[model samples]
Target: MRLRVQGLPTAAGVTRVLSLLAVVAAVGLLPWLSGRDPALTVLRARSAEQEPTKEALDAVRSDLGLDAGPLDLLGSWAADLLHGDLGTSWVSGTDVLPSVVSGLQVSLALMGAAFALALLLAAALVAPVLVRGRRSAGAFAAMLAAVPEFLLATVALLVCGVWLGWLPTSGWQGPAYMVLPALALGVPAGGLLGRLVADALPAVLDERWVELWRGAGVSRARISAAALKRVLPQLVPQFGMAAVGLTGGAVAVETVFAVPGIGRTALGAAKSQDLPLLQGAVLALLLLGLVMGAVAAFTRRRLLGPALRDASLALPAARPVRTHPAIPLTLLTVLAVAIGWGLLRDPYTVNTAARLAAPSFSHPLGTDGLGRDVIARLGHGAAPTVGTAAAVCALSLLVALILGFLPGVAAGAADIANALPPVIVGILVAAAAGPGTGGAALAVALISWPPLAAHAAALVQEVRASAFLTAQRAIGASPSWILTRHVLPSVAAPVARHALLRLPGIALALASLGFLGLGAQPPAPEWGLLLDESRAYVERAPWAALAPAVALALLAGLAVSGAAYAQGRRVPRTGGAGSTGSTGKKKEALVEV
Candidate 1:
């Protein structure tokens, strides 16, 4: 019997087209939904010093054709798009195409460099697992993955640019300026993609054919290549995800390094409320995302061809390893203690006389430029940052569980949704609802579901193909019984665990949104807001920034170590040191979710 591919090419194609239309409609509706006067915004953007007056605003509105309704404007933009026109920038009055194209060139170059770095890092992590059968590298990779792009970029800027002066800190001047940003964007993405690759390696290696190749004396290089091929089809989606990640991550990285990329341009456009330019930037990113998703889907189809139905013939079971959770637990304890200790002080209390003070017995983490206790802010900030992250994770899990069962819908939707990263989503949400912690949380939740959904869909497919389920079906077990007894239990646990691991990254994304001024406003004690507030004063009172920064890093590290312990692999104890005989049992955990 043939297994029908989920949402065959035609259905997926239609889904993508609809997704594009939906995004266009949303962009067109922004002005109306936001309830902001486009004419006044344009006037201010063009001449910030100019005061808004009825006559001037009306003249500007008449000149720009803002008198038309949103639908009418959308129709005009669509018509122009068909004619290879992308409309004009509201701020600069230049054709949007040229500016967008220029930004894309720089962004693509940065993304390419970042992709290369990611590949290198992935290879570094995967090579040891494939060649030496060592799984310890996974824990390190997890740590690498947990570091947020913004934090990493800031560190790179400080060390490479300021302290060592080894590379340019900010600009798109030359390749020298690209290094830090590329590393910032690539490292976490590499760690993420690499761990996934490592997770898939076990099942591929456990195949009987792998043993046959070894028995036949196939060279190690040849065998490794074959193993990779077996896993590549499954990994294509992840590769697409990594591509989206790099694209979205470029926003923060570019801002830090001051690269003239589309992301930065879009961010600037949003801040200045340049509707046309903002629309163009989002459109370009959407197209890039769809194109990348298409490429991944096409590649997966080609790799599988028509011969590979029921791909999960044998779902490899991973024996859990003994892991001590003490370290992760300890790290978390320290953070909790710090926050608890900080709660005793008034975060709002300002001591102007002690502004930017260094750490002292009176002030544990010193004072901010505004003279607010860093410890109190750090303590108070935990609720918004961590709580929202937790909420986002929970909502994402629910959506993932629901969408996971609908494989076709999930696959197509993942492609569309993955394009809009948290920052991009925040841009849209901020435009619509106004920037605040609530909107930022909503934005994070919107983009956070796709990964979990994809994971659920894959697991659903695998569990449905399992022999036990097939046997039950043959024996006349009802569909609901099989689903409830076998499917949900199998899919839910792994997906929830995956969501648990993602908690820190989610928090980081929220912080990033805040840092970009799309989240909690100043004086709210949001971690990202605090980072933003202290950045200018970083050179003077490094302690103010360092407090929150250290808290974030510790949070990430705790997640990594905790995940490592939770999913620890069982290593063979009795195998001879040089022996490859135990290689077949050396599979990484099956769930890299």
Candidate 2:
């Protein structure tokens, strides 16, 4: 939470910037690494069957800088970059600079609308703090955060466009068409911000400063303002991270709404595997996120000013975990049954007779372009998608437990792992594993564990230092017994909760890779890969795309619900004010486990 001098690069910040730069550089080389002749792919994209003559190939290699050394290519691109040339599109044979410029405007506009709506929604959540609805607000946010923006766009389309006939479903019409999409994007974004706000606020209000204000006969309104002022700086990072991820999330959102923003451009580039366009778009998004983050951080600090200072007084400790409904468990149960059923059937069998049919009695989810059952593929995909997610969460929980006992190494490794965005991790994993569902699963599972591991490790370390654990050690309890019986059982819920919370992230990573044709290849029927296959025939068969998206969102909801359920459990509170801790002295009772 420490803010260095304005524009100073902390070791972590520098590592992040370098990581992104490396990703962009590595991304540029992907077309060459694909094992396809870069020249042939470029030529074929432009012509139906351009004869792959040696002379023609050689000319292409020269024109596209394919034959140049990496440093030479970098120098060439750098020179071009100075002159405002982002190179030409491999497929379209047009300058990329103009496209990037125009696309940035569109993305900014779309993002602005989304942010405005998100801010309003966030403001409304603050009301619950004054009232007595903290638990209810948390539940609401958990529900919203569980659902992805794509599904939200789908629901908006169904209601505003189809059901009410009040808005257009698929276009970049004027602001009218923009409203639903903005809402679709913003609500979930805001839900997360609300959760962060709520989580941070109780601790702020519990600060000894607030008690001092009360003792000094300060007005309640002033004390509340003071609490919010202090909490606002903590929010800066979350807000920026959310915005950066939202830019990436926009790929799905824009695709669903048919908005002509950078997302759709990136989606097209991904599907076409157009190297220059994809690289340009990826670089743009990455740079956009990094730059926007820096700007947002500066702005937050400048605005907060003195409020950014750390308090000498101990803040309110964490709140007591509350109880909630079992909706998540019930929902996950239903989803598990569906996936289990899918595991029993093969979705790849071609049924040409029902080719391209709409949803009907026999084909519950309808048929795809090749007459394969969509439901079958979706069902079959469940074992990989959901099952992979489950495996990841379980693995993360296990790793965190083992590593939690070794804080120094765990914290440093987690910090490094968490610094790299999931997209970078996914792409690297995909490249290493090659193209298959199993590879995709492994890539996702590997990338998805870090943040959860970091959080879990921090919490676990706190648990390990408690009085109960010390007492257990003195009671002739072996380390093995303490970890297996005492530690694992106690920390399991929190770890489970973190894992469940990561489902949307897993879903997003899967879809991004799937869109790039790097996910489960033909007949595997993964939702993301389904979306990829269906994009071409969207006009002919919209349901093909819609079904998988809805299913993915539904599953995400179930996962979040499961997390909420885990969070709501009445667990034994093991540590509080009496415990000597990591951060500082604990004046207030804040339960650790």
Candidate 3:
């Protein structure tokens, strides 16, 4: 075993070392690369009141360690990081570690609560599909993922926070205060889990052992349990991925809810261009993601064990396949009807007088800045915003899928494409397209490509080695047929999971662009546009800014929950046939087929 391990050609050790180095470099450089100017700006802003005397300026600089030369600063920064000191915040003129640590607790609380809720919600929502064979579950998950998290958060804040007065507008006052924000975060994540579980189940169902179980007269519940158990081992890694992705949404949510979390702090710092704060926040986030990923990988290696080893060694033979029943489609129909009804009725109608006024009952969702009906505007806005996202995701996924498959089919090009940095692509595309719908779309497409490409490449590799794909190829199946029937179907589960996982981040990016005056134009009724408009009112009518900010956060949460639910639903399990089967037999069957 030792000889074989040593003789293996894989560069896992090198990869691990490189990954660590990359992380270190990234964390170290952020303060210098993206933070210096901001730190200086804040220092200068502080020093302005004291006159631009050299002593005052020097004092401020010295206080921030800016008095040191760049190399010395970098060295100092490295040394501090090595000792777990995040350095002092230039903006706050305080030690960075305590603030970061304090903020981290809040963020983690929000994230953890949201994640737990999302998982529970997803399990309940997807259970019907698993037990009852309903396809609507999948569509509902898709639609949920389609809705932007910012938008969802807005609706929740208005309906739940304002109208119903069930929750406070902002602030983490107590445990109750966390509920709305957590739910807002959890809904989209749960939805993603549902979609993933839904998609992954079909693959497990198609496995030959499942047929054997069925032949043994296993009840549907028993079959589902078995399938779920088998798939759970694989599903854990996805949970980590979801957590990583949700970090961004969590930030937005925490900000909207006035949670005083790291995310909120980061946003404040970013707006003022507080370099050290921004760098610290971003580095912390990156570190969180890396840690989650590493943990997931380690867990997977530990749990799967020999099965993984065997999978890497010998490919199994193909067997007849069976399609699981479609998810409950009727649920989607009902949801659509509800959404339509909600749109038609006076969603904002407060009282009898308001309902009966001249301009009353004018619009269900009310009116915006241009005297346009809010309901009508939302209806109109939905198509463009949501539709653009769908288009962007599709385009991005298509590009990624093509790139991913090319390596399997044409090796060299795939290598080159994979080697290219997505950020470079994004910059190039953004530059060429310029700001507008076209530019926004191009940016989203480019930014979304990397993850999709990675997933697709892995899926392609898996499909290439799968028994079904190989069997089809051996039987002289056309390349297209092999791709469509064998490869594509096999990859669908992961692709759907990937798409849902990416949606919130992509929407946030789009929102950021809009906030930067690059995506939606003025008076467009977009969340980003609202944020831009409300910026001047930050101190006075802070609610103006708060409203949109909260909305963005909620929308992000919904996207995360939706994605999490979908992903969870797709995960496979393992268990009994007809509620009675030997543990060894079940385990063997799960492993064998």
Candidate 4:
């Protein structure tokens, strides 16, 4: 009789155990390593003051669990962790876990609100542009991504805090204080999402199913919806990754805004070398990232299964492409109008008047602590924050395109360049240029290189394998001619997509740097500087911090969402009539591409 044994080894149990062990090691060892040198040095310094009696030394050692062996230390830590004892904060003399939990609640609320707002704004902004086939929208989105969140926050703080004197510069108040920070965060995210949708749409257009739907007399709108559904599953993982990065980046952002969130708490802990608090915060963030990742993976698995099962089915016939001429012009007009209206508003006058008078019919958005009109400040602030981001995006994209193109043309050299660290380039450029706009530009340019290189390499590989490219080469066309006529055109969509995808993250990072005093200097209305100034007043008037913090968070959220939306809408159509595969064969499509 055949034994009813399992066919393969059940590695799931082993994997789970190993994963848990890894987590434990990471959480425990990292803090120990970071604190060890400083702790030992402190101990040595203290030893010179007076040699403690052996009994007293032993008592202190036992209290800190320092006398225990490695295994005992690990066991004690694990036990404490399991028992909800996160240890005491060296600085605050309070239980670390409780403080972290309280701080996290505020952070979660801010993050959740900001993220939701961003997603909504992104969808709204991107849908119309994508439906109308505006290529410039993608570029605009990329520009938004290029501006850093720290820079945006700083600008907001300066314009709103200093010039208008409307909002409090630092501290948490309530939901209202979150609006500006959230918007500041969301705008860039929205811009990037818009670009992503634009890029993804072109790919969807080339899919056999889309063509089939069109041939079957389905409306373009319906086909678009179906394509979005298919592409969305793939986007989940990317969104999760972005979210994870945002969590880490949020620390600087919250600190800059002086918001009483986990990020601010984490910063405080880091400064004081509060090992337990720091570790706890890091672990919580890690767990959050893991959960998001798992959800994304599950969604991808489910969506990919059906796509794979329908590999060989013949697609319906293609329909004629529809192009819109007025959409781009109309969008440009709207942007111009919005900017003009903003320029006409005077924030300082509004703030002064509002402070002298109470809330009335004229000031609908209400006055801040200094009696500044919120509407006027937002209007004035929009110019610099949005304009700087636009400039950064354009400059970075240009740099990316140039660098990206190099890899496609010279693979070996490109690979070498790609391997070079961005920090080295940033340092070199910063040294050459002083820490001003010039340095910011250089840093952005350096950071942009890797993404561009990767995209260029992929495009080159794709071009090398394309039938059209091969045919052109076979006919003895000059390399320049082939590249100009065939290769560039084919790779345009992917290149555009990559540029857009990088925008929001780049912008947020740059903004964070600016907030941390590494970017723009004083006298300029930067969000980070405002937060720094407001820290002293945080306990008394939390609204001072809350306002700018919320603004920053919102702007980042919007930028990311917009990019994702844009990517979702774009469908790749080059190389073949409707083939999804790079080899021009019918097969199950995975969401990876």
Top of the candidates by lDDT: 1
Worst 10 residues of 2 by lDDT: 584-593
Worst 10 residues of 3 by lDDT: 584-593
In the range 5-63, model 1's lDDT, one tens digit per residue, is 88666655677667767877888667666657888888986899988999999888788
lDDT of each: 0.81, 0.66, 0.57, 0.53
Off by over 4 Å in 1: 1-14, 47-51, 302-322, 454-498, 568-591
* Model 4 lDDT at residue 497: 55
Question: How high is the lDDT of residue 219 in model 1?
Answer: 92
Checking candidate 2 for backbone clashes, the offending pairs are 206-316, 207-316
Top candidate (TM-score)? 1
Instruction: Tell me the deviation in Å of residue 274 in model 3.
Output: 2.7
lDDT of 1: 0.81
| TM-score, predicted candidate 3 vs. hidden true structure | 0.63
What TM-score does candidate 4 get on C-alpha atoms?
0.54
List residue ranges in candidate 4 displaced over 4 A. 1-24, 35-59, 69-71, 206-217, 302-593
lDDT of 4 by residue, 1-593 (tens): 64535775333434444554754564565334443432332233346465566665665556667566556767777888899888876555579898889888877776676667657766765676447754555555655654454545656766677567777666788765776666566665665565556545655667687678778999977876777666666565556554554554456557657887776675565445565676676566556556666666677667667756434332322222222434434444544453354346555553444443333466533444455543444445444444555566667556555654555333333222222222222322332343444455455554455455555555555566667666777889899897766666555545555656555455444545445544455534344433444455444444444444554555554444444354345454434522223422111111111
Total clashes in model 4, counting residue pairs 3 or more apart in sequence or in different chains: 80
RMSD of candidate 3 to the true fold?
10.3
Q: What is the C-alpha RMSD of each candidate to the true structure, in Å?
A: 5.7, 5.5, 10.3, 11.9
Q: Model 2 over residues 239-297: C-alpha lDDT tens digits?
A: 88778767766766777777877766765665565656666766677677767767766
Ranking by lDDT: 1, 2, 3, 4
